[model samples]
Target: MSPPSGATTTFLLIEHRREIADLNERIRNRRLQVLSLYGTPIVVVLTLLVWAGLKIFIWLSSDTPTAINAIFFSVAVLLAVAAGAQFYAEFTATVWKDAETPVRELRLELSLADERHILEARRHTPPPTDRQASYKERLPQELVRLRIESRHYRRMHLMMQWLLFVSSAAISAVTAWYDPPQPAKGVLIGLGFTITVITAAAGYFKPRERAFNLQQTADSIEQHATALELGISPYNASEEKQNLELFATTVEGMRAEQRMREQQLDQPQQGQQQVI
Candidate 1:
């Protein structure tokens, strides 16, 4: 049978591809934003809990002035209120709905396309011309997901690092500011313990390092894919099949390295549990 006209089929395919890409990007960004929003509240709430707990503990144990203790207590309460408000605002945000609308519309458009047009569109789309293209075609969705996760992990790692630094500094300042019997001393001790746990957790999880490794692997895969697509040096072989097999093997090796890194990160926790 005669194929569909080139102009119409090509146009449809290109438009669909572009729209899908746009929608996917929007969805990914929105999800990351949501993750960030939730992360802030978690940190804020945890800090408030620690602050309030230590404040109460010190107020009960020490002979600190009532007025000063009341002021600190009020500050903690205010902070709790502020954190709750922020969480409420974030929870009410509508980015998810906004992102989903376009995705649904795109899906509907695809479903409504005539079957022959669909086939024609697929045929009109360019084939994978190199190892890079093949890799992309094989794992387009996975690559996008990994990229998003890596970015999210990087942000989380940065936040944890900052919190660790600030908490440590606050502990030192608190210790230097007052005598041993002050209720605030309890607050400092609590913060110090929290900071210690955060430091240990950060070291054990190594989110920053994991994110870096994942990003590096993704970039390496992309670089090879691009080289293959361009038929550039090291991928400028006449035998396309051989080049593709080699590319796949290299990508698999990178993935294996990623798994090994994850296992190494998990070893500390495993050892602690075994000892317990």
Candidate 2:
């Protein structure tokens, strides 16, 4: 039987395939960078801040008063703050970037392609439009909007980073103006310790929270994908495989999250039952 002539199904398939291919390639190539740039520097800056704070605390807590104590203390505090700010900014940018829209939408496109391929494979009468669509496709238009939202969030993250950087730097500068590691290293040692604790706390929490969010989002996506597949023909081999892959990825993540949550719930419950 002849296929739909004016429907442009082939073109749709080709276009979507190319797009998914491009996105997958680009995403794969840049995955390392995205992971690295999004949050790694925060760790380094945090470490420095911690060490600096510890040094500052030791200096301030000591009874052996060095004449340069004030100056050293101030310098350590300022530098630690600056490091923290820079790390926070970078992390903010990273989270938004990781959470952006391409991840979901590209998979949806693959699903559309698969639907087309499936119709072709059925070897039945080809109609004007391919009616066999998987439930996996949530909505292309909505997905596009989500991608936009993701980028917008990324911009916000960038702004946050800058805010952190400038604010921390400014604080550091203020401390520096008051005192520097001028005449004696002992002056800054105690101040370093104090600054480290504070800076480390801020830096770690800022990005760690974002990581937690990503893990949470990943779990949500997994649930949606599973629900989608449950309503569809999973054995439809003629369809694109990418959607399956995406679903599989999310499913694994969800399973892990479920296990963790279950463990948390049972831990407390088990303790109570034991007491009873």
User: Number of the top candidate by lDDT?
Assistant: 1
**For residues 96-116, what per-residue lDDT tens digits would candidate 1 score against the true structure?**
444323445544554554444
Poorly placed runs, candidate 2 (over 4 Å)? 1-137, 177-276
Clashing pairs for predicted structure model 1, backbone only: 132-225
Clashes of each: 1, 25
Can you give the TM-score per candidate against the true fold?
A: 0.49, 0.23
Off by over 4 Å in 1: 1-135, 269-276
Tens-place lDDT per residue, model 2, 137-193, is: 533343444345445545555655665566556556656766653543443444455
